[model samples]
Target: MTKITFVQQDGVRIDTEAENGSTVMETAIMNGVPGIVAECGGACTCATCHVYVDNDWTEKVGGPSMMEEDMLDFAFDVKEASRLSCQIKVKDEFDGLVVHVPGRQG
Candidate 1:
């Protein structure tokens, strides 16, 4: 399992365990992370699951795909580290991954 940390908009931090191969959004939503609404489930159709990969972890987390990039266009406060959680698959290397949840989902 990958140990992922979610920093909420309010600055609250949550630590959750994610199964390898599961999407980040799934792990977040399943563990009840407050800021990830995930309105479109894991379809990459909605920007509700937008998160900012931690500066240190950004390169490893990588960027979104074309489809996910289009969806992220609808997210609020988009940043260089912005990513659709659903599009990010959890992996062993992702252990200790840190992400920040936006204040609102666009």
Candidate 2:
């Protein structure tokens, strides 16, 4: 299992263990982390699972695909590091990944 920390815009933090190969959004939702509604259930169709990857972890987390990129445009606070959590698969290398949730999530 890998540990993933989720920091909300309000500074609230949620640290949880994620199984390798699972999406970060799945881990967040399963652990009841606020700010990640995951209304579409990891489908990359909804922007509800939006999160900002910490700068230091960006290269490891990687960028979103064209479809995810297009969906992120509809997020509340889109940033260069913005990513749809559903599209991010957790790996052993992401053991200490840190992500920030936006203030608002639809």
Candidate 3:
């Protein structure tokens, strides 16, 4: 299992253990991390699971795909680090990944 952290808008942090193949969004939902609504599940359709990859992990997490980038257009407060958690697959390399949840979904 890999460890991932979700930082809520209010600055609350939720730490969780995620399966190797699961997405970060799944980890958040399973751990009941508030602010990650995942309205479209992991389809990469809705941006409700949008999050900002922590500066330290942005490069490792990489950028969004073209399709995901399009979906991110619907996310609130899009930033250089903005990403759809559903698109981020958890892996051993992501053992300490951290993401910030927005105040609202777009």
Candidate 4:
């Protein structure tokens, strides 16, 4: 398992464990982490699972797929580091991944 930290807009930090190959959204929802609605349940259809990865880990996490990039356009406070959590598959390399959740989701 790998640990990932999710930081909400209000500075609230949520830490959770995830098994390799699971999506980040799955880990968050399973652990009851706030700020990620995951309305589409990792289907890549809803943009509610938007998150901004820490700058240092951006390259490590890689860029989002074209579909995810398109969905991110509907997310709140989109940034260069923005990503749909559902599109990020957890792995040992992401052990310390830190992502910031924006204030809104819709």
Candidate 5:
């Protein structure tokens, strides 16, 4: 399992393990990590699962796909670091990924 960290809007950091093949948003929901609404589940249709991948891990986590990039337009506080969590699959390489949740949804 890959360990992921979710930094909530209020500065709370929640750490949990995500099984391989699961998405980052799914891990957050399973762990009760706040700020990841995932309204459209993992369909990549919405941006409620938006997150800011920590600068240090961005390269490793990779960028949004063409579809995810389009969906990100609906996210709040879109940044160079922004990503749709549902699009990020948990892999062994993502053992220590860190993501920050926005203060509010778009």
Candidate 6:
């Protein structure tokens, strides 16, 4: 399992053990990380699961795909590091990955 961290808007950090092949949104929901409202599940149809990839892990996490980018247009407070958590698949390399939850969802 990979370790992932979700930092809430108020600076609460939720650490989770993520199974490989599962998306970040899934892990957050499973672990009850607030601010990750995956309205469309993992279908990439909504930006409710939006999160900002920590600067230190951005390159490793990579940018959002074209489709994900499009969906992110509806996300609240979109930033250069913004990504749909559902689009981020967990992997061993993602251990210690950190993402920040926005103040609200779109």
The lDDT of each candidate is 0.93, 0.92, 0.93, 0.92, 0.90, 0.94
Q: State TM-scores per candidate.
A: 0.97, 0.96, 0.98, 0.96, 0.96, 0.98
Model 1 root-mean-square deviation: 0.7
Model 6 lDDT at residue 83 = 94
Q: Whose lDDT is higher: candidate 5's or candidate 6's?
A: 6
Candidate 2 colliding pairs, count: 0
**Global Cα RMSD, each model:** 0.7, 0.8, 0.6, 0.8, 0.8, 0.6
Off by over 4 Å in 4: none
The clash count for each model shown is 0, 0, 0, 0, 0, 0
Q: Which ten residues in a row have the lowest lDDT in candidate 1?
A: 59-68
**What are the per-residue Cα lDDT tens digits for candidate 2 across 57-84?**
9998889999998998789869999999
Q: Write one digit per residue (lDDT tens) for candidate 4, span 11-94.
A: 989989999999999999999988899999999998999999999899999999999999988888899999999999999999
Q: Which of the two candidates, 3 or 5, achieves a greater lDDT against the reference?
A: 3
What residue pairs are clashing in model 4? none
Worst 10 residues of 3 by lDDT: 5-14
Tell me the deviation in Å of residue 16 in model 5. Answer: 0.5
Write model 3 residue lDDT over 1-106, tens digit each, in one string: 8999899888889999999999999999999998899998989988999999999999998999999999998998999999999999999999989899999996
